[model samples]
Target: MADPAADAVVRQMRDAIMDTDLKLLQAVNTRLELVARLRAYKRSQGMDFVDQAREDWMHRYLAASNRGPLSEEGLHEIYGRLLDLTKAETAEDDPAG
Candidate 1:
């Protein structure tokens, strides 16, 4: 029962959201590549693969910067997943892993 013009507008909005999702994916991939480069450098220097202190620092940073309906805990949990994924990718790229 939707009007044709309204339907077209909805489709355009959906496409725009999809493009935004793609951009987010691209940004994540770019960050992962940077993590890989860091891993390579650390490996060459015989450094550890995991840095718990840095991860903790990120948790603190995100928690302090959170300013939304989402609780700081919620932000930490979501960002924790991202950090874990990044760590896993970096670990996989590490020569020691």
Candidate 2:
């Protein structure tokens, strides 16, 4: 049988990882909420959602936001995925309008 202490340690690590994931989920949710607001504001301005300038700005923002824990590429990838999802969401709203 596996050592009891080792099993306990694994459980502790798993719990910590879950807690971190929950926090990340909350942060991502907040970011998505902001994206939705941005979509609304753009609509008000008679502007399209897919703005190259905005994407460039996001790249610069992400570049400037480089901190420890996540590499720049990883950060970009995460935001890229978020942007993709945001675009899809906005597109859905458009087809129905």
lDDT to native, each model: 0.85, 0.79
Question: What is the per-residue lDDT of model 1 for residues 10-48, given as tens digits with 9 covering 90 to 100?
Answer: 889889999999998999999999888988888888887
Query: Residue pairs in steric clash, candidate 1?
Result: none
Cand. 1 TM to true fold = 0.76
- Which portions of model 1 show Cα errors greater than 4 Å? 1-6
Which candidate tops lDDT? Answer: 1
**Clashes found in each candidate (C-alpha, N, C closer than 3 A):** 0, 0
Each candidate: RMSD: 2.7, 2.9
Which regions of candidate 2 fall more than 4 Å away from where they truly are?
Answer: 1-6
TM-score of each: 0.76, 0.72
Q: How many clashing residue pairs are found in candidate 1?
A: 0
Tens digits of per-residue lDDT for model 2 on 1-97? 8876579888898899999999988987787777777778888888777788979798888878787588888888887888887777655656423
